[model samples]
Target: MVTINLTLNNFSELPSLLDVFGCFGNDYEYTTRGLLRRKIPPVCFICSTLMVHNGYNPHTKEGPGEINIGR
Candidate 1:
């Protein structure tokens, strides 16, 4: 498994990251305490962070967007 330390300063980059990781599956989204949350797939998270997966697909390219975690 791979881990990424992301500092999201803005919301714009959320969608882009979600798309790139193919995390749009039905079970990917959920609501917790009235706040919407997304579940990052272990494979997607690993592949995206490490930039290497045994079964990596060439079509899915790394996202060029930036996430701002600032409040």
Candidate 2:
């Protein structure tokens, strides 16, 4: 068996990482040093962090084009 390791280079890479797991199905596993032993939220950390990075604030809905992503 061969094993591969992945290091998250940036928050922007989150979407690509998600695509990898979605395509891999049961072949992938989330193996952090000691994180897998505990119970994490069902929402998943990557998606939540990405949403915040994209300025998706639940409390503020200023307008349709209000988000300043600054890209």
Candidate 3:
């Protein structure tokens, strides 16, 4: 097995890094050091943050041009 390590100083930098990995697809495991763990998804964090900032909700009538429950 092989291990890859990355250093990041800000939470906001996460989205762009993930985007780079995604172009390669399914051949990596992402984790943080000494904290929590999660499986990443194929969505853009920046976009999600912006949507929330704009008062758009997946369950609302004005979210991302789609209607209700999930965006």
Candidate 4:
């Protein structure tokens, strides 16, 4: 498994991380509250699971902290 600690100071860095993780199912954004938000798509089960396991909020698909990607 691969693990990465991603620090996204701006929105532009999101795409690269998604591509690296094959998590292109939904577009993600950071809320003003410093939470990561992503739309839950029907075909994004794997992505959602990955997010959840990484400490993202399952219900809101958002997390409060630095972004981390792992496999």
Candidate 5:
């Protein structure tokens, strides 16, 4: 099984839809290897979990902190 593990240190973002959309922007891509990798994307583990828990549907506004995407 493949697991995408992320860690958000010092999280302060309030969350938002745009943040989620932007997360899949230019930097991110899905590979045939069944892995999602990104570069310079604004996302963290907390936000990611929130996105997944909400079915990738975030609803908050006024995001905080600089989110860094990881594998």
Candidate 6:
């Protein structure tokens, strides 16, 4: 299994998307041993974990210390 997490420096400035798309499929490709392999992309349901900690960031303070202080 593979998991990927991404953070954008200019995330809030992103324009609204007119449409969204998602898929749960796999790609068939030959491996080094000439055997067919299925490559699947990881699916992320909730990704907005955090940007940084400490008492900083004047923008959305989504970090654990600022936002989620408890639990």
Best model number under TM-score: 2
Question: Per TM-score, what order, best first?
Answer: 2, 3, 5, 4, 1, 6
Most accurate candidate by lDDT: 4
Please, what are the lDDT tens digits per residue for candidate 4 over residues 1-71? Answer: 32334556745776775566454333654445655545442333545344442344445445535776996
What value of lDDT does candidate 4 attain over all alpha carbons?
0.49
Answer with 1 or 6, whichever has the higher lDDT.
Answer: 1
Task: Write down the lDDT of every candidate, Cα atoms only.
Answer: 0.44, 0.42, 0.45, 0.49, 0.44, 0.34
| Whole-model lDDT, model 5 | 0.44
lDDT of 1 at 35: 34
Could you tell me which 10 consecutive residues in candidate 6 have the lowest summed lDDT?
Answer: 16-25
lDDT: which is higher, 1 or 3? 3
Winner on lDDT between 2 and 3 is 3
Could you give candidate 1's per-residue lDDT for residues 1-71 as a string of tens digits? 21222455535566665555454445434332333333543344545543222334444456756699989
Q: Candidate 2 vs candidate 4: which has greater lDDT?
A: 4
lDDT of 3 by residue, 38-66 (tens): 23433334454323322433543336474
Report the lDDT of model 5 for residue 32.
46
Return the TM-score for each candidate structure.
Answer: 0.20, 0.24, 0.23, 0.21, 0.22, 0.19
List candidate 2 stretches off by more than 4 Å. 1-10, 34-71
Clashes of 1: 6
Candidate 2 local Cα displacement, residue 40, angstroms? 19
Clash pairs for candidate 2? none
Task: Give me the runs in candidate 6 sitting further than 4 Å from their true place.
Answer: 1-26, 41-71
Off by over 4 Å in 1: 1-5, 23-71
